[model samples]
Target: MLMLPAMARSSCERVIVSADPAYPPLHWYDGKQLRGASIVIITRILTDLGLPYELRYLGPWKRVLYAAKNGNIDVITTLKITPERRSFLIFSELVLNNPVAAFVKKDRPPPFSKWDDLIGLRGGIARGNRFGSVFDEFMDERLNVREADNLETAFNMLLANRFEYVITGYHVGQAYIASANIDDKLIALQPFLIDSQNLFGFAAQSPCIAYLPAINKQLEKLHKEGFIERALAQARADWRKTPIIGKN
Candidate 1:
């Protein structure tokens, strides 16, 4: 683990946490509040640390990030570490591996075996989504990908032929396919675009930043104990029982 810089203790009353409501099995909005493995893990860590925390349902994924950028939210339970995100947040230890994939219409799966194959294609991705710094830079400089407000809309547009593909988390795409009963319509291409790590991020300007080192230590303990695996399995089952509401 990398050592974090020393910082003054926080006078923060409670940690405010939020995540993409549209992302599932990891974290998602269940209409009323956030749910899934990320929530289960982070809240448990806070409790163990004897810290008060609030899991705010701040609408869309983009808004949740905006709140974090402005220090309105102290922690984001799960997100890939990207260069732009690092500007406003300090990330914790690796929480889990999040593999990103390109979803194409079943009948038109691209001849994609490498990143270079995607250059001329039109792709769709949800707003505030990032695969990694490399792919993000590639997308900006070489690919033609558009952003939709959320995954549901991006998938819908893909189905409507508005775009050739939609790039998102492989598991998230699968969950959406099952929930929407569109299993026959879309498929995630093999050889994932990128496999990224999901980590808890504390806002750089939030008083909660003081707890990052402690949080990282706890996260390391959880990973070694395999608690995160159990939580994810439980979260997947819970997600199936709840209805997935579309975000605006």
Candidate 2:
């Protein structure tokens, strides 16, 4: 792990971090505590740097984004970069590369060869997510998009045949399917929509913004040393042992 210079590190003490409580295997509320790969990795990084910090399980995914945007929260553990979000947050280097894919009922899979194939299909997406700049723009202008408050709701809607497909992070969708025991009923389409990098970002108006350089440096080191990979592997194992139920 890379160590920040003492002065730079000191400024980051007592930082406040927040993430969606339901995004599991990456981050989630385990009834009493916030737990997941990102949470565990980030906590270790902060501890190793001797920076005291607070982790918060804010309301929903949208609420977490709202808090981070207004500087009510210091850091957000995982988010995809977009022009709108860039207005309120300064992002760190890539923390995890999340592949975005579409889920469909096994009986009625769509002909999904490329991005353009999704244009006319009815699809569900989480309310505040941005798959990538290209897909976001496409959704805005062309796709038949339906927004849901969370992934579980979106998946439920898809299962009920309310929509033809639901787009989500590949691993997250897989975990949700296994947890909900819907793998036999649904399938993820081939050729991901995009590979999005999950990042740690500070609110633009945050006091912790000054420490972003140091944070990025440490994050890069962690990524290089396989700390993040190890944490993710462990989290995947844990998720398999006890799959998480999707919130209704």
Candidate 3:
């Protein structure tokens, strides 16, 4: 079993959680409120613990990270655990594996079967999305990738040939394609970039860090009972039912 550090003794009045507004089936803003598996799981954990909490939609993914880093947000419901993020956030145990994929236009798939195949080709990713440390480093050193403000823009850009591909979370990418009715234009390349783990991150300076131990324990219980998988499926179905929130 993975052991978390000793629990903090500070008093936490409330836990404010947020996530990338574009990452559906994990977390996203559905026109008005945040919805998806990550939000469902985290909120359930907090409720069971009897913790007072508020789920905020702070806007873009970049601003959400900024708020968490500065302790303006108490928790990021789901995100890749990155070394840079460790500076100000204490992460919970690995919640689940999330695959990162390269989305290319169907009629113009790039020469991509390996990581090196992507070098020298132009790609785009939503701002604030990271695959894993190794892939991120490789992308920075050799890839010509643009960071769009959101996934919708990245996919539209891919369609417009602004770039050859859009690298993003596989499920969320699928959600966007489906919601926008653009599945005919784009498809994810085989063999994902990386299978990254999704985790809950608490602002290191926030009193909410005190609940890390309980959160991890509840997460373990949920995982063991298969609640996480069920939640993910339900979220995907729910997303399909909700009206598409923004322009395609």
Candidate 4:
């Protein structure tokens, strides 16, 4: 039902946007189509810009990153900046604030008050996903981090006592817990490890890389109009309707 603006129509050039189909509330593949807060926001921005684009649900997080790095994809709906990623991507202004937290089983919560407390404990993270520069550095040097294919897999491993905790976005963790009917069994550790600002990014070599400034400008306008907040709320409500649990 959503149509591109007449004034914003484009030629044959199309921007290929890649996103992790398993990351919900933010975005996820609903059997046949991609839908979520970021999807809606990006859709509006692209439509307003009159840009031809295709939204692809290539996932497992790692594959999405690989595609973006190789310029096989033009844009990623959301990602946090990392030094390695910076080599191949140019990021837009902040798109959303995602609070990173550690989730643990309720019966055996770890005593973690500071970053150093995480050392020695087995923790799970999505393969090829970075929490932040500092956390990633600490993880590399001190923590015993186990990699999973996706957040759900990591959470499952945590529940099976394969790991002491699983690190992921707070909202995402909570959504999965609820969806899996394990809310009473799992709890997100307080205070958060990091508050990451999610951003739109373009492959450095993509022809659409030139559109960064325009995208940022539109993102700023969307923020000012409270469009982002409204879209997020709608996304949360919609996600709750299905409450999908598993790979995505």
Best by TM-score: 3
TM-score for each model: 0.90, 0.89, 0.91, 0.89
Which candidate order results from sorting by TM-score in descending order? 3, 1, 4, 2
Highest lDDT scorer? 1
Q: Which residue pairs in candidate 3 have backbone atoms (N, alpha carbon, C) closer than 3 angstroms, thus clashing? A: none
How big is the positional error of residue 132 in model 4, measured in Å on the Cα after superposition? 1.8
Q: Which stretches of candidate 4 lie over 4 Å from their true place?
A: 1-12, 245-248
Q: Residue 99: error of model 4 in Å?
A: 1.2
Candidates in order have lDDT scores of 0.86, 0.80, 0.85, 0.82
Model 4 lDDT, full chain set: 0.82
Off by more than 4 A, model 3 = 1-10, 246-248
lDDT of 4 by residue, 3-104 (tens): 442124333388888787877788888777788888898889989999988987675677888888876778888878899989888899999988999888
Candidate 2: residue 138 Cα off by (Å):
0.2
Error of 2 at 91 (Å): 0.6
lDDT tens readout by residue for model 1, 18-95: 988878889988777788899999998999999999888888777788888877778898999888899988988898
Model 1 lDDT, full chain set: 0.86
- Looking at model 4, residue 167 earns an lDDT score of 89
